[model samples]
Target: MSPALRRHAPLVLVALLVLYPLLPFLDWAVTAIFGVRLQLDRQIINVMIFAILALALNLQVGYAGLLQLGIAAFFAIGAYTTGILTVDKYPFQLGFAGALLCAPVVAGLFGLLLGAPTIRLRGDYLAIVTLGFGEMTRVVILNLENITDGPRGLNPIPEPVLPDWLRDGLDRFLPADRIDLAAIHWIVLAALVGLLILMKNLERSRAGRALVALREDELVSGCMGIDPARTKLTAFAGGAAIAGLAGALYATNLRTTAEPNTYDFSYSIMVLCCLIIGGLGSLRGVVLGALVLLSFDNLVSPLLTRALQEQLGHDSTSVFANFANWRWLIFGGALILMMRFRPGGLWPARKREVDPATKADA
Candidate 1:
C-alpha cells in the first residue's frame, strides 16, 4: 500500500468508530441548532437499517452479479417472523432474542427454498422468477389474515432485551420507556458494521473471487470446478439472510409489522435503485446509495408534499397531496440521468493490484 493510504487508514477507522457511537448525539445537536424537535435519531436509524438492506442486496448484485428483483420477499419474511415471534401471538411467546436469531434463519431457509429450484436459471429469466416470487410472498402475507393479520399488520411487538450493564447506562441517558428505539438503533448499527466488515473480507477471499468469476462467465467458472448452481444459491441465501435480518430489525424498531402491501414491488425496486445508483459491486457505493435514497424518500418527499400543498393553497386531502405518486417519477429521472452520464455508479469500485516488479523498480 502507498504510504499516504496507510497513514490515513487508521484515522479513517477511528473517525468512523467515534461517529457511530455519537450518531444520536449528533442528531440531537442538529435538532437543537435548528430548534426542531423531530426524532432525528429515529430517522438516522431508519436510514442505517436500509443501508444494511442495500449492502445485503449488494452481496448478490454487486459481488455475485445476481439480478434479484424480489429481495423484499426475504425482507418481509424476516420482519414478519420477528413480529410473530416477539409479539404476543397466540400459543407462542418467543422472546426478542429468539426472534432476532430465527428471523434470519427462517428467511435464509426461504431463500434456500426459493433458490433450490431457480438457481439453474440465469439472466433475465432468473430476475423474472425472483420478481414473481417476491410478489407471491407479498400476496400470501396480505391474504393470510388469520396468521399475518393481513392489512392491519401486527402491533405491540416486544423490544429486544439488552445486557443489564448497557441497558442501565442507556437508561441513565434516555427515559426508560423510550430507550428501546435507541437500543435497537445501536444493535442494528453494530450488526451493519459487522456485516460490512465480513463482506469486505469475503470480497478479498477466494470465495469472493469465485463469485466474481462466476458473475463474469459461468462457463469459465464451471470449467474451473466451481458449481454455478451452488455458488449462486449460496449468494442468494446470504443476500436473503441479510435482507431478512434488516426486516426483523425494522419491525422491532417500528414496534409493528404492516400488511404484505408494505413490502411491495416498489420497496424492492427502490433498494435495487440504491445499489445501482450508489455503484454496483461496491459496498461504499451501496451505503452511499441507501443514505441518499432513503433520505429523499423519508425527508425530502414529505417536505415536497407540504410545499406543493401550500403553494397551491390546497387542503391536505387534495389530489396532489401525496408525494409518493411523484416519487417514482423523480427516482426514475435520476436513474436515467445517472445511467446516461455515469453508468458505473457514483462510486464505482476500482480493482487493486500490487505489482512486485513496480515495487522493486521503486
Candidate 2:
C-alpha cells in the first residue's frame, strides 16, 4: 500500500468497526451460526460512554501521575447533578440540555474541591484521600433525601429530544430490535470522535507537556518553574469535567435511575482497571480498554449465558446465565496479569519525539 493509504487504513478500519454493530447483517450471521444474540446496539452505546470516562481518567492517572481511586465520585456528582436537575424531585427541571451543561461544571467543581487539599499528597496518601472522597460523595447522595430521594435514586432520566423526522426514520423504518433513537448513539459517537481529537491535541499541547513533567518528577518540574499543585489540580479538574460530561450522557442514555449504588467504589476501580489494562498514556489503549471490558460484560458474557442455557435447558442456574456478574473477578485477574507481564498495557504507549517547530512556537 502507498504511504497515504497506510496512513488512512486505521481510520477506515475504525469507521467500519464502529458502524458494524449498527448494521443488522452481522448480528444475523452471528446469531445464525453461534445461536447467541448480541446486543450490539446497547454495547456500542456503552463502549462510547465508558471510552470517554477512560480517556478522561487517563489525564489524571496517566499524564499527571495522580493516583485517583475515586473517579466515580466525580461521575456520581455529574450524574446526580443531571438527575436532580431533570427529575421532579427538585422544583426546577433543567431537562437534557441543562443536564449536559451543568453536570460537568458540578463535577469539575467537586474535583477542584477534592484536589485543592489533596493534590499536595502523593502515592498511597492521595489514593486514600480520593477513595474517601468517592465514598463520601456516595454517602452524601444517600443522605440528601430531599433532592436526590436518598436511596431511591432518580428514575426515568430523560433522553435527548431529537428531530421527529429523524426518530421516525430510525425507529419506524429500521428492523425490529435494531435500536431506538439511534441518532442518539450517532451523536454520541460524533462527540466521542471530537473529544478524542481534542484529547490527542491536548496530549501534544504545552499543558500536556507540563502534566508530563509533573508526572515524571514533581520536585524537578517545580524547580524548573512548573507549579506542581496548580498543574495537578488542573489535570484533576479537567478529568472530572470529562467524567461529568460522560456522566450526563450516561444518565441520559440509561434513561433509568442514577442510583448511588451505580456510582460506587467498584465503578471507579473498574475504569481504573480499564486504563491500566489498555495501557497508560496510550489514547488507543483507552479505547481498547473500554472495548475489552464492555464487550465482555455486554456481549460475550451474555452469549455465554445463552449458550449455557441451551446446553443445559431451563434448569441452568442464574449464576451461569449472569457470568457478567463475575466481571470484577475477571478484571482483577486481568490487572494482575497486565502488571506482571505487560506492565505498559495491551496497547502500550509509544514515546513521541518533541516537534522542534511546535516547541519553538511554544
Candidate 3:
C-alpha cells in the first residue's frame, strides 16, 4: 500500500462500510457473479449487531482480561427493556428513540448489580459464576410469562422514524421496498462506528490504563494506587451497557424481543469466539473478526448450503446439502488451528511503547 493509503486505511474502510448499503448495484453484480441473491442490507445489519456484541465482549475479555460468560444476560436485559418500553402492551410507549436511550442504562445498572458482589472472584470461579448468572437470567425470564409474554416474545415494536430530508436522500439510492431496511442499516452502522470511536478513546483514557494495569498485575496496580474493584466494575458495567445497546438494535431490527432462549450460553461463546479469532485487546481485530465470522455464518454458509442443496436436487438426506450445519465443527477446527499456530490472533495487540524520555531518565 502507498504511505497515504496505509495511513488512511481505517478511514477508507469506514467509507466503504458507509457506502455499502447505498450501492444497490452490488446486489445485481453479486447475483450475476455468484448466482445467489444477497440481502446486503439485512446481512450487513446482522453482522453489525454481532460486531457490536463482540466489541462489548472485547471490552471485558480483551481489555480488562475478565472472563465474562454471561454477556447474553445483559443482551437480553437490553432487548426486553426496549420491548417493554415500546410495545403497545405496556403503557410507556417510548417508541424506538426511547428504547435506544433507555436500554443501555437499564443494562448498565444490571451490570453494576451483578458486578458489585462478584468482582472479587477471579479466573475459573468468576467464569463459573457468570455462566450460572446467564442461565439463571434466562430461566427467570422464561418463568415471567405475565411480564415477558414468555415464549411468544414481545412483538409489533415501534419502527424508527427518520427525518424527511434523510429519508428523501436514502430513497434516491434505495428501492422503496428497502427504505426501512436501509434506514436500519444506517442506524446499526452508525452505532458500530460510534462505539468504535468510544472504545478507541477509552483505551487512551486513565481508566483504560488502570484496567490494563489491573489486567497485567492486580497486586502491582493496587500498589500503584489503582482500585482493582472499581476498574473491574467499570469494565463490567461498560461492557454490559454496550451489549445492551446491541440487543436493543437487534430487537428493533427484528421487530420483536424474541424469546428468553435467544440469550443463551452459545451466544456468549460466539461473541467470545469472535474476540479470540480476531485478536483480543485490539479494536481493529474485533471488527475484522466480527466481519469474518459473522459474514461466514450469515451469508456464506447459508448461500453455499443452498447452492449445494439445489445441485443435489434438494435432497434432504444428503450431508453435502447441509453445509451450514457444520458451522460449529468448522469453527472448532479453526479455533484449534488458531491456538496451535497463530495464538496471538489475526491482529494481535501491539505491545505498549515506553516513552523515550522516561527510558532515558531511567
Candidate 4:
C-alpha cells in the first residue's frame, strides 16, 4: 500500500461502508447489462450486527483474556428483553427504542450475576462455567413458554420509528419504499461506528492497561495494586452489554425475537470463530471477520445453492441443492488452516516494545 493510502485506509473503509447501502440507487450501467441486481443492504446490515457481537467477544477474550464460551446467553437476554418489552402480546409495550435502550443494561446485570461468584475461577474452569450458563440460559428461555413464546418465537416485534420531522426530512431524499430498510441500515451502521470508537478509546484507557496486565499475569498484576476481580468483572459485563446491543438490533432487523434455539451454544461458537479468524484483539479484524463469515453464510451460500440448482435443473431434494449445509465443514477446514499457519490471527495485536534501557534494568 502507498504511504498515503495506508495512512487513510480506515477512513476509506468507513466511507465505503457508509456508501454501500446506496449502491442500488446509483443506477450503475453494469447492473442492467448483467441483469443481476445487487440488493445487498440486508446482508450488510446482518454483517454489521454480527460484527458488533464479535467485537463484544473481542473485549472479553482479546482485551482481558477471558474465555467466554456462553456469549449467546447474553445475546438471548437482549433479544428476549426487547421482545418482551415491545411486543403487543404483553403489557410492557415500552416501544422499540425504549426496549433497545434497556436490553444492554439488563444483559449487563446478568453478566454481573454470572461473574460475581465465578470471577475466582480461571482458564478451563471458567470456560466450563460459562458453557454451562449458556446452555442453562437457552433451556430457561425454551421453558418460558408464556413470555418468550418458547419454540414459536415472538412476532410483530415492531420496527423502530423515527420522529415525524426526521421521517419527513428523509422522505424528501429517499423513496418511501426504500426508506425503512435504508434507515435500519444507517442506524445499525452508526451504532457499530460508535461502538468502534468507544472500544478504541477504552483500549487506551487506564482500565485497558489493567485488563491487559491481568491477562498477562493475574497474580503479578494484583501485586502491582490491580484488582483482578474488578477488572475481570468489568470486562465480562462490558462484553455482555455490547452483545445485548447487537441482539436488540438483530431482532429489530428480523422483526422477531426468533426461537430460543436461535441463541444456542453454536451461536457463541460462531462468534468465537469470528474472533479466531480475524485475529483476537484487533477492532478492524473483528469487522473483517464478521463480514467474511456472515456474508458467506447469508449471501454466498444461498446464492451459490440457488445458482447450482437452477443450472442443474434440480429440485430442492436433489444431491447438488444444499450447498449451505457445507458451511460447517468449510468453517472447520478454514479454522484448522488458520491454526496451523496464521496462529497469531489474520490481524494479530501489535506487540508492545520495551525500551532497551528498561530491558537492561530488568
* Model 4 C-alpha lDDT per residue in residues 1-362, reported as the tens digit of each score: 99999989988888887776556555455346535654566767889899999999999998999999999999989998898888889899988789889999999999999999997897889999999999999999999897789998787788877678878877877777566776778889889999999988888899998998999999899999999999999999999998999989988999898989989888998998898898888887888899889878866787788788887774778755888878888888877988899966788777779899999999
Query: What stretches of model 2 exceed 4 Å from their correct place?
Result: 1-6, 17-30, 164-180, 305-322, 353-362
Instruction: Note the Cα lDDT for every prediction shown.
Output: 0.84, 0.83, 0.88, 0.86
lDDT of 3: 0.88
Tell me, by lDDT, which candidate is best. Answer: 3
Task: Write the residue-wise lDDT of candidate 1 on 295-344 in tens digits.
Answer: 78777777677678777774778656779677888788877987799877
Regions of model 1 farther than 4 Å from truth? 1-29, 32-37, 314-323, 354-362
Tens digit of per-residue lDDT, candidate 3, span 1-362 = 99998989989877987777677778788778877677666777888899899999999989898999999999999999999999999999999988999999999999999999998997678888888999999999889999999998888787786789988987776787567776787889899999999988988999888998899899999999999998899899999999999989999999999989999998888888888899988888988898899888867898788778778874867765687788888888877888899876899988889999999999
Top candidate when judged by TM-score against the true structure: 3
- Every model's TM-score: 0.88, 0.87, 0.93, 0.91
**Winner of 1 and 3 under TM-score:** 3
RMSD of 3: 2.2
Error of 3 at 180 (Å): 1.4
Score candidate 1 by lDDT: 0.84
1 or 2, which is superior by lDDT?
Answer: 1
The superposed Cα distance between candidate 1 and the true structure at residue 175, in angstroms, equals 2.7
Error of 2 at 15 (Å): 4.0
Number of clashing pairs, model 3? 0
